[model samples]
Target: MIAALRIPLMSLLAAAVLAGCGPNFAERSKTAEELTDEVIYQDRRRPPSRLRDVLFSRTDPAKVGGVNKYLWNASLEVLNFLPVQSVDPFTGTIVTGYGTPPGTGRAYRATILISDPALDARSLNLALQTRSGPVSVGTQRAVEDAIMTRARQLRDRDSRF
Candidate 1:
């Protein structure tokens, strides 16, 4: 009968279309098996991880959690008036002997600690001293502000490259 023939023909057409639509899971699994013997697969577990992982890793040789160079240099440059008693770049500490500023009669000393390499406000710690004892809060704050501003300027200048 014509109706029976049409039903079989439609079934055959549907099967053909579905087969050609795309590779099924079995075909995909077979392709993956074939690719397993490739060099890419062999090196998949190699060092340095995948590209995405390396992008997030810390790989910069110059950067450490220690003192920031910009802040260190800026501290020295800003506090050049004071006589440097000692400086340890490895430990990120600067101890200065008391000395009078050019326009002021007050003798001041400073102990600067660059705790971090980032040019952030918290990285630069300034301890100002006078002949009597620690200087006023306003004076300490003003000096800290000056050092932080200078440190930022230094960082910005270096970033241009």
Candidate 2:
């Protein structure tokens, strides 16, 4: 019947139209490699082309999440007794669960923040807490001072290289 023919004709017409929507591969155009290169180079947002460059490029240490690497490493080294709960290098924050220091009976937890790129006392923030409550200011300051001293030692050792 005409109605049955109309369905087939419409399908055929739709198929032809849809087929034309694809790229015309028969025409000469940029090859895959050329197209890829164009896309990569044309955009300024693209990362380095070589893996080695991306991995080993000499960038400013301060550019790493605005954190002093010495302070970060020092905090981890000094607080290695505590079990690390979470560490975000990008945010320059380290959180550790309760763990007693060597020769200490009471368990303590710590949160360290490296707020600046400078290897100075002001860049390191330390909060120590015991199961009872927050530790006294003197204890907090002592821990912070240890971290800063260690950070200086690390920087000094690195500078010798």
Candidate 3:
């Protein structure tokens, strides 16, 4: 019947969508570690992050968790796929901001002072630059809070523990 056909069609669509979805957090974390190690650690020509030159080069990044991770990840989320040209670990400055333009309804900027290089890039400044939905302020805050909460959990679980 039509109902039977509809159900299968919907299920097939769902499966396709799910299959196309990317890796989750754990996978991303592993990939990031590998990439960082190869690019920043092994490649001596590249400037070293605190993590890269220190004893914890591999194990040390583990000491930071929660908002830090969220903060770092958020930078990557905002930056998305921009290539890097220059960097200074002492300060947080990405120089370039990527993603949708601000007028479209979503944007923000956060200038974070970074003391560690193991985090994402050293952007002495990060401006989210997105269009704000009708309720964007609260929603963004909520999202930031969730990131902080997750960060707190990460810090507690990984570093503090």
Candidate 4:
């Protein structure tokens, strides 16, 4: 009797542990989709000196709730949706190490040089500085802000996952 009970109890405990490990598959997928949307359809904004804060329902740090507030911070939002491994919000720059074709040389670090904000326009000067030359993300502030607003709504309304 004791041996049989032990087997059943162990199985139950194992089930509970797995259940508490992380969010379910659907939740994980949803989170991934959300992140991608933010990146691909990210707000097209001018370079900002500071990230503006949107009011979101307060969440307890001890609890798994609400959007990642840290991500919403001014600098982070600027570099949130770039095709890069990671970005540093401060100093207004982005570094990417993605490679070209298979036979291409080592991946280059592309720097997106963001300058100060301008009147009636946001300035995002992009300097690939490679064979491709430079590009600009300037004057897309309105689109970027709109997308950011929508993203905030998505997070604030649904607290799950």
Candidate 4 Cα errors over 4 Å, as ranges: 1-86, 101-109, 117-122, 131-161
**Candidate 3: segments with Cα more than 4 A from true spot:** 1-70, 73-88, 94-96, 100-127, 131-136
User: For residues 43-80, what per-residue lDDT tens digits would candidate 1 score against the true structure?
Assistant: 54445658988788765433333677777888899899
Clash pairs (backbone) in predicted model 4: 43-144, 44-140, 44-144, 45-141, 51-74
Q: For model 2, which pairs clash?
A: none
> Considering every candidate listed, which one attains the maximal lDDT?
2
TM-score of 1: 0.60
User: Each prediction's Cα lDDT score?
Assistant: 0.81, 0.87, 0.47, 0.45
Better of 1 and 2 by TM-score: 2
lDDT, candidate 3, residue 5?
100
Per-model TM-score versus the true fold: 0.60, 0.67, 0.30, 0.24
lDDT of 3 by residue, 7-80 (tens): 99999999999977966655535567677768766854444557647654544353233223444545445444
Worst ten-residue run, lDDT, model 4?
62-71
Please report how far candidate 2 places residue 87 from its true position, in Å.
0.4
How far does residue 70 in candidate 1 sit from its true spot (Å)?
0.8
- The CA lDDT at 75 in model 1 is 86
Per-residue alpha-carbon lDDT of candidate 4 for residues 20-118, written as tens digits (9 for 90 to 100): 896876653557756776787688533333444333434343222222332233223443443476555544455654434245453323454334422
